[model samples]
Target: MGVKTYDAVIAGGGLIGGAIAWELARAGLRVAIYDRQEPGHEASWASAGIISPAPEHPGMIPLVPLGKASAGLYPRFIAQIEERSGQRTGYRAQGTLQALFAREAREELSTLVALHHGLGLACDPLHVEEAREMEPALSEELQAAALRPNEACVDNRLLTRAVLEAARRSGVEIFAGTGVEAVWQENGRCAGVITSAGKTAAGNTVIAAGCYSAGIGGAGSYAPVRPARGQMLALRSPALQIERVLWSERIYFVPREDGRVAAGATVEYAGFEKKLTPAGILSLLEAAMELAPAARDAEIVETWCGLRPDSPDHLPILGPTDVEGLLMATGHFRSGILLAPVTAQLVREWIVDQRVSLDVERLSPLRFRDAPNPAS
Candidate 1:
């Protein structure tokens, strides 16, 4: 190949950044990704892999297309990776079954149903008995439920491994433990990024550092990304074979291939602190017990905390910034894993065609007009 300075330098080797780097490499760009730790072991690894755009807020209608488009890309993406890497992403289209436990939760179901339907998605409301019949482990007190048949999920950890493999196979260099110190600028335009390792990564750097995107210099106010801590737990339950992804108000359970049930997530604004708390763990356990009694008998195998990259407007920051060459693809909140596929494509288009096919104006990095771009 030509003297490689890397056609694109991706900050952060998480799902979003890794996928983008892989796609860019496939698009004939010599790409490299940097991460402070192991790729996919953060929020992307600490997720339940529920790809449902089902239970999301009705207010997020504008972004539903983006999510659905991403969801569509996943099947082919996972298929390619699984074939190439011989590692299963555990891609499942079994759908998500969300339950209603209280009157308030029942009321919330209507809004979810409407939103899903509006997106041309298939949603079926089921009576309590029907719901329990579908999942006999459900409590008798369950009020209502809904199923979005097209909703799907994947084993996020496996997906991450596949992405890492695909990227490596595509000749993308991954530098773990290389943190970005700052984005270098000269003449008031875009330049390069300086790594904490004392190395300078230049020529089309994409700041996709998840929650830490704000810490990098020249990230500017463009980084509206915030760190929302989510505590998760996994239980080894050979007794509970959940056929589909199950969800209640505060918790959800996604079954993996190894007879382990992945249940999660308490969203707390705990600031960069990834420590798992007893209170959060207790709350999730109680919720799990309520949702699936079999879970109460299962052994708690693991617990962890992940930082969801959130934004001020509760939407992800996508597309180019005011900086000439620097692009942003962060702040996915709880949906980072689900949105990874599309984010990769969107970012690759920006790097290649200098445009994306999706209507990403709503996720503009410059959305906050008063937000100032920083200097290196």
Candidate 2:
């Protein structure tokens, strides 16, 4: 018997891949997503779900437009997914606060605020008292803070599940616990993927396997993604009434509507090992306590690690690859949730419509063809 073929076969069933599957399937394409484990249980579940461009580096300026575009589409995008999938994603628009503890950091933040304002992003500098008024749980000794009113967050794990459900509703075939061993090609053009179960053919293939993307056979050195492990913990504090996402230089606090606080995360290049270290938890807990002293008594509910896909330049590797009919949409690092909508929309445009409305040349997989390996 011939192997079953799909219009699109996506490797890696994380948020990016799931979103693409939902979009493509909704557009009447027969799509299938294969993941080695349960979909979205990896980095997507471990994410803090904060959605904003503030935390990105200055070098990621090229991606700002894409991030903004995704942020703009999130409201409608999430609502549609929820309606279609019949699941709530815990979406919140309470905004975010960048807290400054010292005078030096406050001074530095002023420049960042100015830059953001110049770029037309809505970031307002807040007086210490005003900051306290907005988030009464904040430390009283904070020197300064800034508010990004447009920034929002969603429960990424819930969102992932919703996307997967919506994809299924749109007739996308999902294959969990299926690892694609290689990109099966013929006549020098991209074909399909080889999985432990067998070969699955597709007219176009997308490698969205997160940190494990670069290792997929037949991809060669196209995807320069590497594993950057991040550690995070959640605190269940019913009494802590925090309204917005709080950010400091060291840690971030995301207040869930159910009174749980999500605190994270440490960026460590410890390879594929995802052990939860005590130091990682201590540093996060200390920072969380500094932001809200009462949180010290909060019960630590969960601690886990995720391997984020990090490119050398730290921007997402999206759009087409050198191989025809093959695409790449991994290496989103911390901004996976923030960039999912735009990535899906653009990928759909490029694959089904033959062109992307946004100029994503910098994000193309071809950018690192001549660049030296990041490990060196």
Candidate 3:
């Protein structure tokens, strides 16, 4: 027998790869995903699932457009996934409340409101009473607050599994435990991947292996990605009822439909280590209790850590590379969940139509060619 071939071979089984594979397969292409381990067990499974388009900091401004676009696509995206997989994604559109606790919180909130308005984002400054009315569990120290009504959150663990199932239902073959060691280049063009099991040929190849993308031979230059560890914990409190996702100085709390509140996370540049430290856990607990006093009495349900893919610039490395038939969709860092829908749509457009509706020139993998090797 000869080596198996496909129209597209994605070298990652995480949300990015799975979503892309599903989109391609739905478009009548033979798509396959090779995952080193179980699909969706990494960052996608470990995310808090906040779906806000507002930039967390000024450095993330460039991603706001992409984030907003993805946010807009989420309703249809979730409906399709749920319809195809016969599962619920636990998507919640109750929005988010950002609270300020500093003594000068009112002044700081003014600055925050100005920043959001400058970015053309919807931000409604709220009186502390109004914030408390929305979420009775808010800390008494919350002096100022803002509401981003368009923001949302989802059960990411459920969403990831649902996407994977939807992909399978759409005819995308999944090879769990199949590690792709490198992109196979032939005749100066890309030609699928060389997996640990064997070589697989394909017309086009996409490296979406998250932080491990840099480990794949022949892909380091375009995907100089590294891992950023994030530690998080979950709490259950029958006495505390939060209707919206709550964000404070050092922590954000996401309330699930199952009565679990997810609190996270400390971004540590600890390479590939996924261990949760005592300090990390302690800080998270402190922040969580401070954000919502009732959380102090909540039961600790779970604690976990995940490695987020981080590029040197902390922005996603997307689009085609200089090598023909090769593309990249990794290094999304903290916005992987928020950017998934747009990423899948863009990758599919590039593969099928050879063009994209959105201008992603700055996110191209080739942009790293002139920059210093980040992996070095």
C-alpha local distance difference test of each model: 0.82, 0.88, 0.92
Q: What is the TM-score of each candidate against the true structure?
A: 0.93, 0.96, 0.98
In model 1, residue pairs whose N, Cα or C atoms come closer than 3 Å (at least 3 residues apart or on different chains), thus clashing, are none
Query: Candidate 2: TM-score?
Result: 0.96
**Candidate 2 runs further than 4 Å off:** 371-376
lDDT of 2 by residue, 201-257 (tens): 999999999988887886536677888888988888655678889998789988776
The residue-level lDDT of candidate 1 at 248 comes to: 89
Ranking of predictions according to lDDT: 3, 2, 1
Q: Residue 106, candidate 1: how far off, in angstroms? A: 6.1
Better of 1 and 3 by lDDT: 3
Candidate 3, 1-376: lDDT as tens digits: 7999999999998989989999999999999999999989999988899998888777889998999999999999999999999999999998899999999999999998898888777889999999999999998888999998889999999999999999999999999999999999999999889999999999889999999999999899999998999999999987778888999989999988899999999999987878999999999999998999998898999999999999988899999998999999999999999999999999999999999999999999997777665566
Question: Alpha-carbon error at 103 in model 2, in Å?
Answer: 2.5
Clashes (backbone N, CA, C under 3 Å), per candidate, total: 0, 0, 0
Candidate 1 error regions (>4 Å): 1-4, 103-111, 199-201, 372-376
Clashing pairs in 2: none
| CA shift of 326, model 2, Å | 0.5
